[model samples]
Target chain A: MSTRRIHAWPVRLTHWLNAFGMFCMISSGWGIYNASPLFAFHFPTWSTLGGWLGGSIAWHLAVMWLLVINALAYLLYGALSRHFARDLLPLSVSAVRRDLFAALRLKLQHRLGHYNAVQRLSYWLVLALGVLVVLSGLAIWKPVQLHGLASLFGGFDIARYVHFFAMAGIAAFIVLHLTLVLLVPSTLPPMITGGRRETSHE
Target chain B: MSERKKAPPKLEPAQQTQVVNLQRRLLLRSGLSLGALAMLGGCNLQDGDQVDKLLWSMSRWNDRVQAWLFSGQRLAQTYTATQITDPFPFNAFYAEYNVPEIDLDGYRLEVSGLVERKQPWTLQALRQLPQRSDITRLICIEGWSAIGQWGGVPLRTFLERIGADTTAKYVGFKCADRYYSYLDMPTALHPQTLLALDFGQVALPPDYGYPLRVRVPTKLGFKNPKHIVELFVSNQNPGGYWEDQGYNGFSGI
Candidate 1:
């Protein structure tokens, strides 16, 4: 085994911070939603963060600053470092289709320091979903003041649905991401300690 | 035969015991780590703890941000009469049956704090003031919203007429139903803000605040106190029923 740099410091920092922020936001959001649910079913109490509606709102509004600031930092680093372009871009439909089939067949290659076509596409999609959730959140939070943003999602009522679906997309992406990490266990060390390549076998 | 050969290597009893011990250690480590993480996150802390204090301060910071974002000139969207939500949902801290019943003849709107006129206002006096009607959306903190046609005196005109200190930082309301809420000065003076007396073409039903309520289109519904009995202007925030319980004081929407 050899050690090398895989994930940059900025990437690791933002990744964990965003993880924490999203955990707070999503759990508290469930609490807030249960107050006057738009849908029929309510999120189970065990899955919720804050104990009550008021407590949930306090946590949600508080964590909002952290998430927004962390997102901005990630975006700036991704742009200035060309990290997004180098890692997640230039994805094509054919490459994704090929990778999808290979993955399903358990024939996909696991490279130590690179993302596959499917990984790239999923990362890009989750990033887009993150942006969407934040924008829709802002629209609903200040519908009258941010009328233009609210109207973009058809209106305040629809914006809530957009926020929910975007959250669901991000949650799905997280599940897929964790499953991949578990399947490719060697991938986990690099994310935490920068890199540790086990070169005994493919 | 080749596949059998590939699976020839098997763990001996000693090695199997070692693996079991390793798994047990891993589980214990993970359990401890999870406990530590939850503690560090302060998720289990009670109210008035460091976490709660931090959350409260952040909520207040959000209030300041919302206040800064507020504009006097930007009007909330208005709809036509036909667009109003038919049978607008009744909401309060209490059930509909508990909606306060105030005698209209004996009712007097108390005005105090920085106002030149300390006189109480009658329903007739408020009615006689120049009236306007607006069909605007009432957004609740609970995430539901409804469009209602509200008719009454513009709050700004009422403040001016009552000789209120327009420069006051806070305008508080005491409701007949014992529910209370307050608004920031900018919201208090917004042109769309109404001391609403009528819902639709007729007088406001008891369920909808009877003879008086605040109709602030820009704020979340909680800020619009119903069956208002006392109106006061002050430099200090008197806090609110829900707000004291931890809801954001300035919930603008």
Candidate 2:
């Protein structure tokens, strides 16, 4: 078969936007969490983070809405269009496993494959954690709606701590994620532009 | 001259212009971003009072709009007991002072102004009335929250005991630390509200406002002033310290 371009446009947008939004959230969230100051901003009652607290809250809430909307659209479109399996779910377990280890090796030869199955696995795992972040956030923010959700995580204070740690873990993942992208931009373009200039086959 | 050979010419006008234009664009874009960042970095106000009032009023307005739009639904959410830890780990600075040495027991909760009962009642007397308990939050405005069970008489019951004058419009609380603040009578005596004495099935801890404190669930932590030594009825807004220092007087949930 002739070499062809396979552009999964919806997945592409979700990939890039999720990255951008999460990056914004983590930076702003750090400011909000420490309150006194962690970076760029000073502490003391007089010193509020430049935009970390207020700005992070706005960004976090806004991006959170966007993330939810985009994820919902992706899910619904997948279900309606019968594309979730085709576009997102993996094809073969053996191939996925092999690719996962290959990605893990980070060999110079395989770097151009963009994301290996390992990357996909990590991405999916982080997405699941994102759900936890949202749930815990809501529990702490409005336990009344979910009714008793706050009590689930050992009450409001613990829930707040969980929310913060979840955000931090996701943030750490993003840092690792960006390092991968910087090391492997050939793999990055497919996410931004929906297709990559594939030079070789794995 | 013959050996020197020809060197490559400098550039085509388009190429040279493109290079210069890219530099200018890069410089301008970076400059704009820097300026914007600097602006956001500034305090954006001459004094904290200005910022505090502006933010507080804005918060109050947003709260009102949210409440109006959502109807009677609370802007804050209440939690259920599924994962709720019993005794909801009490973490606070005031815990140290909540010792038995000064339990505020026999503590007279004074009821004065526009009322039939113009005397002080001990904690024992206040507890004699019908008691109310509920699991609710201690939501600090600075951004920490807690959910603990509070036990006390409904503030309305206390008002009833006092035979509050129909003209009385506000209720002021004087605390052990000399903190003085008051609330509109309507808010002070709301049905779910209480002047609490027991926390987590034990006598109220000192720092947690042991002996007796106020629990108006529908407001920020500061509004639920702890360690109240006296309950004075009034028509005037007996401003609390924080309120006088730029916090909201209403301090609703």
Which prediction has the highest lDDT against the true structure?
1
What docking tier does model 1 reach?
Answer: acceptable
lDDT per residue as tens, model 2, A147-194:
468778876667777887788678778788889778767766666665
lDDT of 1 by residue, B1-253 (tens): 1222344347998897566455433332333233224535565543234565576788889999999999999999999888899889999989888888899999999999989998999999999999989999999888899999999999999999989898889999999987888999899999999999999999999989988999999999899989999999999997887787678899998
- Model 1's interface RMSD: 7.3
Tens digits of per-residue lDDT for model 1, A87-122: 788899999999999999999999977788999989
**Residue range with the least summed lDDT across 10 consecutive positions in model 2 chain A:** A43-52
Please give the TM-score of chain B in predicted model 2: 0.67
Q: What TM-score quantifies how close candidate 2 is to the native fold?
A: 0.56
Task: Give the distance in Å from residue B106's predicted Cα in candidate 1 to where it truly belongs.
Answer: 0.3
Write candidate 2's Cα lDDT for B1-253 as tens digits: 1222445359998897566554433332333233234433464533433333334454456444333433123434444544344545443324544533454545677777778878888877887999988877666644566677778998888888889864576888888765567766666666667889887778887656767888877666777777787888777767775554434456454
DockQ, in order, for the candidates? Answer: 0.27, 0.06
Q: Lowest-scoring 10 consecutive residues by lDDT in candidate 2 chain B?
A: B27-36
